[model samples]
Target chain A: MLGDQIRTRRELLKDADRRYSLRQVAGRVGIEPAYLSKIERNEVPPPGEETIKKISRDLELDPDVMLAMAGKISSDLQEIIRKRPLLFSKMLRALKEAPDHAILEVVREVTDGDW
Target chain B: MIQLKGTNLVLRFPQVHPKAKASIEFMRTLRVPNDGNTYPLPAGLGSFELEHIEDHKAQLPEDWLKRGGVMLPMFQSEAMWISFNGTYPIALKVATGKINAITGELWTNELTDEPQNYVVLSEQPWLDGYAVEQGTVRQFVATPLGSGESAEEQITGEAAFGGIQIQAFPMKREVYKELFESPKLTDEVQQYLEIPAFLRRCSEPAMGLVPGGSIAQEIHKDEYGLDAWDLSAGSRCFIHTVNSEAWSELTDLPMPHKPISARDYKSANIPWFKYYAQDKKALPGSAILQKLKSKKEKPATKREDAEIGQNMSDLPVVKLRRSDVVTEGVF
Candidate 1:
């Protein structure tokens, strides 16, 4: 899914401007052109978080969305979860199927330290 | 081609190199008094809101739909400047209604070095107006089409198009790698490459940029040479300027507030700007652009003096010099 998403967006950008070639994007992302091609074709697994961020930056896509699509979490986020494993695990499970606004409300309450 | 990323237009070159990307913003600034006196660069208040033409195809004229780009609202006589951000080296050609802002020649698909039809980034940070003279430019003031104030009306004798046109070409990939990737790259150039990621109304008459008051600004010479740009891989965008009232009617968006008057800004002790790069050379004034009469030379049709009060005397100015190191005094 991540590969499809990236490939589709890249193609759209390329359609508008012919310069967004796979090789060029790979070069900018510091990845091998062959490896990027394989990833786009879904023959290889998505790259690590750093590479994903680089690709997202080059493509002007949201890094968070790309990370979510990749089924990976950023190291900084992992650290945050690690610090409060018990509470975060419980919160994440409770909020798994929650609507975005409801989850936002909880985040707002916690951020405001109103609870 | 230009893609609307929020209000900024992102010009991408996928065929050239992924790093060969640049974003442009039209900044709202004070409309300096065009009372036959040149002034310093004004502060950028904010960006103009932009909307894609495809989204509002039903309401737009057929010609606008055919042009197929983005549109922004602008008030008559309002001043604005272009802000450029590039991840890598890019050559940008800017024109007001098919009239080249640099050479004052008619728009052509090709980039030429004889008169230097384009400005190179990230060396050149911003463009304020027509390149009338060396190290000086007349500010871009919006005027309605057919008013005979716009450069288009003056040169072409017809207001066929009443908006800005932009084309961007990135440096050849090999050339960029050889120049920038090498250890010979200067700190100043490197610093300029690392620029961080960073409107209008509807009226029926349509608006085009006219040379307003003169300002001390330079369109820097292309150090990379004309051959360095990958002219084959270039994209252009047509920016439609709609009047504020019509913009509101078409988009249902609130009109932007009037810009800060020059008098108020001056009274507040806000400093105007003067920028100088010690290493780079400024291009000479265009022979054709210099020959055309500025908006000040003609009779004023719009009441601009009332909006931008005429008290422009003794405004404080701040000078910005590049690549200067301040030595710390011994404590």
Candidate 2:
């Protein structure tokens, strides 16, 4: 089931950018090659919400998509709601505080949630 | 940036071919000040600088000898007079010293350690009009853009009548070298000089590239019978980069960060044409429709009048709005 979700996310990313390679994605997420492969293959359940966020950030994937895929919808969504109130608040925060576009990509995940 | 007060005239070449050469020549003429004393300057220059003396009593060089000199018939910095005509009621807080425009004498405690001495005008002064209150009037200051702490805040009040003429008397080259050689003044002047040159250089080409004003777009209509507007891009202006000569010299040493500043070229308040489909049924129809639409073009809008204030020479000598509105407080 974990492998199925990882593959599904990877396919979505592929649709966004056909040329984007796994190593590029891994480098962006700051995860080791073996660890990323293990997670992708379902040898490990989805990494914690932090890791999912880091991956989403590095890959420029919408954070909401990552949260939905990682099954952290209820818990992770609550954490962001508690911290930053206002719709598109995360996007606003990312715009000011994030250092680079990579940081924006990760924060974007939570901002553009399932709704 | 330094604001130079003077009438800026674009010498129209009714039908001159090769625009680039003509433009370059036009810029060169301004450097030739009206004073007969000449330095090593190009014989053939485009632009020239002129000084308006006080009520026909200017200590100018003789007419035949000063043939090369270009004299502006009306006062330079006419914008100040024009803007002053529509200025609001403002209390002028004059600095402790007197600035006699006729003598070019600046007597202030700050000038000399002994609490009194005069310093001659060393920089080109500009008509810097600052708004005392919105929808009322503006006050003019004789701020030599780079010489002041900040260009925006150095404005002094205008005269009761619309006109106040000040001579831009030239200072000695030695004085300029002494005043400007300092690192701070050099840096400020360099930055100040860059803008006018940039404006002159970029105005034609930049306007040519962008259909209306820096935003690229095509016309389209809405679902309703009415023509709906579409904006291709918004909130953008050209900023000179490190590669530009104007920016390059400022970074001769290892700097903390890049000093890149941009001024807003166009805004919503300023009028701009928008694209709209002539027929509402089609998107970007065959006739790429465009309409000149301005939200702030009404008579009451102050900005439209302010723009008209800038082109004062072209405007008819209309009676200033509410002339009594400001003068009542003074009496």
Candidate 3:
């Protein structure tokens, strides 16, 4: 589920003294307690960029991870694609078509080479 | 509820750190036009309000807290300059949870109008430098961050996204109070700078290319057997927050509904009068600051480097790829 991993990761980060309550965390994060509960239960789609930012902060989860989990493409990556569409497109195509073993080999070969 | 019902409605505007020594001299020190009769401070360093907001609590709105409390309007256009050298861009705690750095305007989206602890979430990459049509001969701007493209059309979301995210903090009131009450300016600006260490700490749980440039990892990814360049400016150069005090006051407001539009920015207006729905009875007619005028230091007769360009003392100077680029138009 979209939120299963966030739930697991958030729990891992929480300490006993700082145990986060759904409502407390939700209030700080600007979400409904029920909404955060739904998020933890994997009962809803991941939130938007702004909400994901709040949730990640409230849960002590990495915001980028939460954003990624929520499937939000950050502005930085979007700009990279916009600037070098040809290179990014080719790189994506190569990665998509390459087998794991071949990709590993290419990775090995590139690593073995010096800058 | 106006919890401050009987309390004084004291509103403060940002002023330069009275004690911090300026690295620059002979430049425009005060943002507001001064008579140039005294100490030459750095120009456009931070914001200042001649009039502090002071009124009875009864004047405030009933839903003041709900509407995000009294707001201190920010002038994002007033850029401040700092001189420092770091391979990675440093983040300035312009406000709580909010940071102005070499890269971008970092913030959280809590949407509170209360005196929220500036929960600086992340300096998401907003802008980057493309190999400009002019190629490697890119010159720097008076301000380093914000808007790299000179042309207006290229300034869209697609062209502007920098791709990094940061977690925020709902810091205790004391934390924000410490920041607000602290000296507003410092020469060692890096002390107030916070690195988005979260970006460095988390690995991808799934597939994604590392958005390249001087992001947390991309700076060092090269020496660690990945792709990177010597883009980190060698030394003695930095990305400084220009109009920093506005950013400092921004922490007290609710999150903006949209990205700050420079076209719509009202720089000359006072914060209490503009953003907040309530009105002040009259202007303080805040007299021209006599304190900044007290010094007898005469304007340099043979003024040193009176030119408008930067006065880079003994510090080493170099340029590298910005950690995150904000297009302030071609320099």
Question: Which lDDT tens digits does candidate 3 get at residues B302-331?
Answer: 132232112223222222222322222111
For every candidate, what share of the true interface contacts is present? Answer: 0.00, 0.00, 0.00
Candidate 3 positional error at B79, Å: 47
Chain B, candidate 2: TM?
Answer: 0.21
Lowest lDDT block of 10, candidate 2 chain B = B203-212
Cα error, candidate 1, residue B52 (Å): 0.6
Candidate 1 residue-wise lDDT, A27-72, digit = tens: 8999998998888888988899999999999999999889998889
- Candidate DockQ values, in order, are 0.02, 0.00, 0.01
Clashes of each: 20, 18, 30
Place model 3 in a CAPRI quality band. Answer: incorrect
The total number of steric clashes, by the backbone 3 Å criterion, in model 3 comes to 30
Please list the C-alpha lDDT of all candidates, in the order they appear.
0.77, 0.27, 0.28
- Candidate 2: residue B85 lDDT (0-100): 13
Question: lDDT by residue for model 1 over B266-287, one digit each (tens)?
Answer: 5565556677777889999788
Q: lDDT per residue, candidate 2, B80-140, as tens digits?
A: 1111110111111111112311112232212221211211111111111221111111222
